[model samples]
Target: MSAYIAQACTIVHKLIDAGHHISDDDLLLAITAGLPHFYDPFLVSIDTLSDSEYTLELIIP
Candidate 1:
């Protein structure tokens, strides 16, 4: 998950350098938004969670 986030940050940084605008919130959303409906329950679970309850290990492990 660290790797995924790192790669996303890398891409986002490039996008910013290229003059496209993206925010941390946007990147966070993009990460989960790319998941298919197969993960709907998991996504919904996270949606209802406090920020501290959400962890990358739950998603990637």
Candidate 2:
């Protein structure tokens, strides 16, 4: 999970460097969307947090 998150962050950073804009919420949503069904519980937990609390720093291990 940590590795996956790292890779996603790397890709996101590259996009940002290339001038693409992506909010942290959208980044997390995209990552969670691609995760397996087994991650549903974790996703549900994440969904309960306020938007301000959602960030790559919190999501990545």
Candidate 3:
């Protein structure tokens, strides 16, 4: 698996082990939502991408 996928899986596993009943969609959503702050480096490093990437904004506050 790609490093990003592996990292995401690890995060999901940890959350599940901690008793957070998050779905795969939810997990991806959370990551995508947080990516602006959390994955800024990765995003910036990839020059071919545009700002149109998916944003995670549906997360419950």
Cα lDDT of all candidates, in order?
0.75, 0.85, 0.58
Q: For candidate 3, lDDT tens digit of each residue in 1-61?
A: 2465568778888989999897755765555555656666754554344434332332211
In model 1, what lDDT does residue 30 have? Answer: 79
Worst 10 residues of 2 by lDDT: 52-61
Candidate 1 residues lying further than 4 Å off, grouped into runs, are 35-42, 49-61
Candidate with better lDDT, 2 vs 3? 2
lDDT of 2 at 23: 86
What is the alpha-carbon lDDT of model 2 when measured against the actual structure?
0.85
Report lDDT (Cα) of residue 14, candidate 2. 95
Q: Residue 26 in candidate 2 has what lDDT?
A: 76
- Tell me the spans in candidate 3 whose CA falls farther than 4 Å from its real position: 31-61
- Which 10-residue window in model 1 sums to the lowest lDDT? 52-61
Cα lDDT tens digits for candidate 1, 1-61: 5676678778989999999999656776878887668978978888887776565555445
What TM-score, computed on C-alpha atoms, does each candidate reach?
0.57, 0.78, 0.45
TM-score: which is higher, 1 or 2?
A: 2
